[model samples]
Target: MDIVLASKRRRFVWSVAAAITAVAAGDVLFYQRGAYGGQTGFALAALLLLAIACRPAIWRDRRAWVAAAAAFAFALQMVRDPGPLPWTLYWVAAGMTVLLPATGTFDDGWRWFQRLLAHALRSVVAPVLDLVRWRRVRRARSQWRFNLSDGLRGVALPIIGSGVILLLFVAANPVLAQWVDRLAGPGLWELDAVRIMIWIVLLVAAWSLLHPRPIQPIMGTFDGSGELPLPGVTVASVRRSLIAFNLLFAVQNGLDIAYLSGSVPMPAGITLADYAHRGAYPLIATALLAALFVLVTLRPGSHTAAIPAIRRLVGLWIGQNLILVASSMLRTIDYVEAYSLTGLRLAALAWMALVGCGLVFILWRLRGGRSASWLINANLAAAGLVVSSFALTDSAAFVASWNARHAADVGGRGAALDLCYLRMLGDSSLPALIELEQRPDIAPALRDRVRYVRNAVLFTLDRRMHDGGWTWHGERRLAAARAEFPDLPARLPMPAGDRMCDGRLKPPPAPPAPESSPLTVAARP
Candidate 1:
């Protein structure tokens, strides 16, 4: 009995402590408020504590109740304007997970509830948001010229593109939409499933009407069993595959542009042609030109003609990949707009990696000897290195942009450091950056630049905390700077000047020095 009581007491204490920490941390991080934030904040903390306390009992048999509570929380949060709780449902569910040792607490019933909710939310939310935003946009831009081709292109391109990509996606993995619906919330799940299914059906119908031919396969296109099969899937096939993939990708890629381009600020010195050519256009063109010879050689009984055709097409493909790599590296170094660089690099890298992998696989198949195995291993290692390099390079720019000039708090040093770490983690090779702080691998100039920004962030954070609250003018400047240079790292520094104070700028108070003279005496008495 004593053991049981002690265990219960320990659990309660831990629960309360965790709850307090969560409340305090959340207030500091997100709301810029403190834990003493009135009834709502306290109520949330109480819920967290209750969750922790009942966790073990919940394991004994509170599965249905937990699910019901979670569902109720989710529903309340959705309806309330001020919001009922901060991720109340998630916290409750997570707490229940800790409590429950048994499997299948939700059972199939929980899944059903989830699906139902997801469908409803998507059905309701998306249309409402779209309608409201659309109305606002229409009112704002009343007299804009409607270019017929542009309008048609905008409409047809996204619809067709979404259709094709979704069909391929669904065909590749039928259960994906259903799974997504389950995870995202019932409303989203239902909406997405319906949207995707409708798109798939439309794409299938449209594709049939268009009667698009299969652009020759890049690999496994030639019948290996056939007499005199064209030299093991000629370069033409590879080019054709590349083109088909690019065209398919472009259609899917334009969805965001179709829907959200209106919200985007017009970039300076960027024309329509420039924007269009910047993304998947070059990829599609590269693939198409490289595969030109394959199309010419597709005629039956004219197989011998493919030799010269393959050579020319392969040369073009290699040339295109090389140019893309060079251009991408230049763009990375020069800081040309990320939108242009990222999409281009993504397609180029994926293509090159795929082709390189295929070649290695083919070599392994043909030469089953030890040397062939070693060669394949080398190719795989090179591929991995390339991928890692690309990730690190991409993340360097990402980390750099998080610099800010606010207080050394949520908006300050901590935030910048977190962003840097996030970017570093995204690349495999940059693990040492977290520990070393200054690696020889990072160029001396780049390291200096990063260190300067990091130090500035630390300084800002310290300085801001010294001041009572983040002042309006300072926050505004930080926001404006962030807007102007989205790619640069934020450089919020710790506060240091005389301005940092309580009544006169000081670090926030310690926990009452663990005792007050009167309170301690009274409690003791």
Candidate 2:
């Protein structure tokens, strides 16, 4: 009993030390480096501090290694160039690092995620509650000169009465009140509400990090008997539904093949754009619904999942869904070609690709009889890789270059160039703008716009260079833009026509008619 109590005391002391260290580190990071840098610093410090507070056995644990890797991924965000995608990925990695240590290897991916959430919530308050209980137990055993309750009761009335008498005496005498007020000293130790709240939040976070409660693994299969309990969903009813669902889906697939694949012309009064736009979104929605239905009816270990015919039908249905996803992609491509590609359209294409991959994985999992956990991890891995790739890629630059070259103004086969949109792309489109300006047959208005945009980009580049704000990639691109447009002017010329002088165009100043205007105004008066 004594050994156990000693060990508990030691652990508590260590936790207190870790908490203090974390709070100090947090304060230094916040006050010195600013919030973004401070957050990154605090995360790194807290991770190290927590590892120290935990058992040394963590070094040999697989989850610990995974957590370390995730922490490294998050650290990359602090030093890398600023990007929304990378920041989002960093947050995901950070969450995994924080939660994965407590999450167990569950057969259900959703269960694992749920456990992570539960652990996070428990960790936030569990330490404080445990500390309070420990203090109460310690107090109960300690032999003090007086019991806390008895001491308080004995002094309560005397303290109150002394306070009342003191107030009355101070009210009656101005000198005594002045002397009491002077004794209060300066407000050096005073804290405002905001400061108090900040300290409370900081301490809470520090304590939570110092003593995170271990998550209890939720053991047991999702379907304990290795089968779903659906009394109404018999083999025969499911078979009928599968047949009807397949037929209904077949009709949609047949039309997609005919119209999307160019086997038959689109219906009269419907342009290709109309057909493509109308089908793309709804087809994706249908595939999503079909996927949901498959998961529900043919869930692993279910009675219907054991039927060979049903399994085959589910696979076939999944394949058809993949085909539907492909059709949606083609439709989006057709629409993009008819119109133009924006960031949103590009994102839609990426999403469709991910959906197609997900459907394929679902079929694979069903065929292999794998758990939902496997399916989920595979999809997450694919998605993480895709997002990481996009984070590293300069999508804006690629879009700008593609649009610049494909525009009708550039002698390619597409709609008219939207210089305004390209200009909105900012510094990433600088090289494309420079290229646009070099074209011989470019319209005069577009050429002027390009020149204006190019000047703005150059000015921005120069400022970033001087301020040391350009990343390696930005610096390299700026160098390339400079090399391509060696003779590009430093500033744009004023517009010659009756155009508005809205910053982009510097209209010529009105002639010096002030003298004549003043004489005419005086004569009229």
Candidate 3:
């Protein structure tokens, strides 16, 4: 008993020591470069040696001896080339990362390979161990272990896929390292983005496995008004959902990165490395928090019982719409300058205000014991507003702004309106634009715009154009006008005649004559 107690105490101390050292080593690897390799090597070697020293036959048994030898080899590789080690050595290190366990075990030397190997072992070996253990227990119960096929069907494939990905990621790290090094040449910000992407992928994969479903209270009310014993969510389903959500998040993040890469590049002046480091912790933390939140919210009864779930869904919708708004805003700018008012701006503002007010209303209603139907109707209205913001805002502003801005040069506001009308018809109205150049009443801007659009369509569709022909009702009038002014060029100035200016579309009325009547008014007075 004394010997056993001593063994337990020693094991506890070693485990604590290994963990502390591993953490310190990881920090050094992240922040420092000089002797970082040596530091990591020493940390890993110390843990391995301590594990072996605590064992009785580790020195005697060949497999235990081999593990120790591998640990020694890792230390040697670390010392030999401290700058940048071989790919194989990194693989060896990665293997060690997974083989080691997190908690109580003499095999802590193998913890180095923990991340890569656990999923595989969980996939392939775990079921076998479970089966054997179940058989041992089942004989007494006179019933077979929980359906073998169900166990295999549910857990087996996911574990294998996860393990495969983890290992592939580790193995691909050397390739990733090369890319990182190349990016590092551009400075740290770009490099940092790359690192952030790497860590996010890893984190999303790892934590998604922890809990995939929502977890709700058995007692809904704070005062225990609706307390009831009930079975809650399963861990496996939650894990799967978390994985799917993370994957979706990663794809969106990748799109963001692609978009930013074209414009932001190095984020003002920060080095890619520093930039990457700065964001790494926060992004990982947020993703983990989100995963936890999603898991809890998604748990089968959690949405029904919890108010927070409703708020979360609303918040997510708001965020998604905001992103859509920003994208639409960018696209709108190609049609006009920023200061000019596009109908989209009004539509977007209206949508935002309505949604914001509705959200506030829901919060208020939630507190006031309103029926679920009220809340549902409110949410549905908000969703409709979101869709309307897109459809009503995109093309209407495009055509109206296009007409207003080019009104002076196109053919006054009238010709500009004609172009707007043509645009509304999409590709089918190309002949109208071609015919617009002949109209004597058409503003030069409108005439030029029509011709340019006509040519663009012809080029795009590879169609032949005749010198003079009636296009259609409006098209025939414009074609005749263009023929009368053959000197007109393809480009037209902004038509000055349109009533549209800045944001407003309606034309102002003519001002009353004042000076000419002043003398007559004076005589009457």
Candidate 4:
């Protein structure tokens, strides 16, 4: 049995070595290239290497195929657009793929999450320790051995003496020193801290990929018939709590309907801006907390969840939460209208929509008696779809265009034009700036600044287009913007002011009306 275990350990070592070599080679050949080709090659190489290392185990497991597909999808996304969101999704998907074969069927999302965390921790530590133990055993079984300590002791004095002699020679003879300097190239022995750190990280990542530890799924026979030990969580108490919560939410909703719906005048000293800004974020927080409470109190298979009255109350509460989410959205819209629209406000609106969807999903789960895992997966899918859509959409361009059209100078309801903000939007705002420049009513000062900004953006876009830095979407947008201003000059005149909006300069006042001629009046008489 000991020999058999040793044999298995040896085979594992060989497999790890092979995988490491393959990964290192692949990194050198493919990962050293640019993002698109590099990511594509690395994904293919990684999947192939994993297949070779895991062999029949990976080949037979259906989960392995799923993991491979996910990896491919991640690579495709990176090739399309490499950013934080796509990378985050790739890491999560890759982590799950590494643990999928080891974990058993989980009964709940919590348990599955717990096992995944454990598996990640174990994968980091187990492989290296096991390799160390195997090496120790192999050393014990060797027929002959040389002590590394004794060998180092034999060479230490000579090495020290040689270093001292070299220093003495360099100090005594300038020519020798000069010769030494000439022979020793600059940075030959110098360490690059960044490169060293990167290599170390890569090595560790490769090690983890090669020897992932298995996670044993929790399969305890203890049925979930036991009740939670909360003393005040009886059905009646939950019902009362839900009723109070509903009434409190109703009051807030009523105020929203009165003020936000434009049906009644706002009270004195309370502006619409104040009303919108104060409640948008806090209401979203309240909805989140309410969702958490419902999940905990009315957990599946719980006694509180079994009561029909409590269930009805929970559904009603969820419905109220949904209304609150809508009101929060309206508040955000109102705020954007009063102020100016920004990326954060747009994100807030999207987040509110997601929250509303989550509330609806929760009510559906409760009605249908779905598992926790189901709810978790459903929400994850929803979030992933939203994020993926956002990744493809150029949000900066949308914000820039909206702001441009709504600026006060353009006969729109928004505040004074923010050329600085538009400039910060980079190439995405070029089209809007061009459109602003073409308007006849635009002040000369503002138009000059707009032309300056547009030219700067166009220069950047032109350079990126020439240098292959611009993506297809960027190129397309630039082409469209250029088409709008067909007669734009090749060069723009510089603006006189440093500030975005010079407060000192105002629009020229209308010329005084000319007095009527006296001769013409006498002729009329």
Using lDDT as the measure, the top candidate is 4
Compared with the true structure, what per-residue lDDT tens digits does model 4 show for residues 1-525? 667765566557566765566555544433432223224435544644564355445656687667656656765555544556656655555656666666565355455566666666665566567667756765775642433345569999999999899989988999998887676533334456744554455555555555566665565322322256577777888889999999999999999999998899999999898999999999999999998887777777788888898898898899999999999999988888776788788988999999998888888877777766677767767777787667656677788888888878777787777777887777768767877888898888778778777776777666655543534545566677668867755543344444333223446678999998777445565
lDDT order, best first, reads: 4, 2, 3, 1
- 261, model 2: CA deviation in Å? 3.3
Candidate 2 vs candidate 4: the lDDT winner is 4
Taking all chains together, the TM-score of candidate 1 against the true structure is 0.23
TM-score-better candidate, 1 vs 4: 4
Worst 10 residues of 4 by lDDT: 29-38
Instruction: Assess each prediction's global lDDT (C-alpha) against the native.
Output: 0.39, 0.67, 0.42, 0.69
What's every prediction's RMSD, in angstroms?
A: 28.5, 10.7, 27.6, 12.3
- How do the residues 267-292 of candidate 2 rate in per-residue lDDT, one tens digit apiece? 78998888998889888988888877
Q: What tens digits encode model 3's per-residue C-alpha lDDT throughout 1-525?
A: 657644644544454444444444433343333223235445445545544554443455555454456546645444432223322343343233323222233322223234344443343334344346545544554343344456569999999999788657746798765675574432333335645544343233222221111122122212211223336543444445445654565565555455434454665665434443344334434433553343233332343335454444534533433343333333333222322334454454444454444545444453454543454455555754464334322344244545444554443422224444444443344434544455577656545566655544433322212222112222332344346657645443333344332212355778986776534545565
- What are the TM-scores, per candidate, against the unseen true structure? 0.23, 0.67, 0.23, 0.68
- Alpha-carbon lDDT of model 3: 0.42
What global local distance difference test value does model 4 have? 0.69
Q: Rank the candidates by TM-score, best first.
A: 4, 2, 1, 3
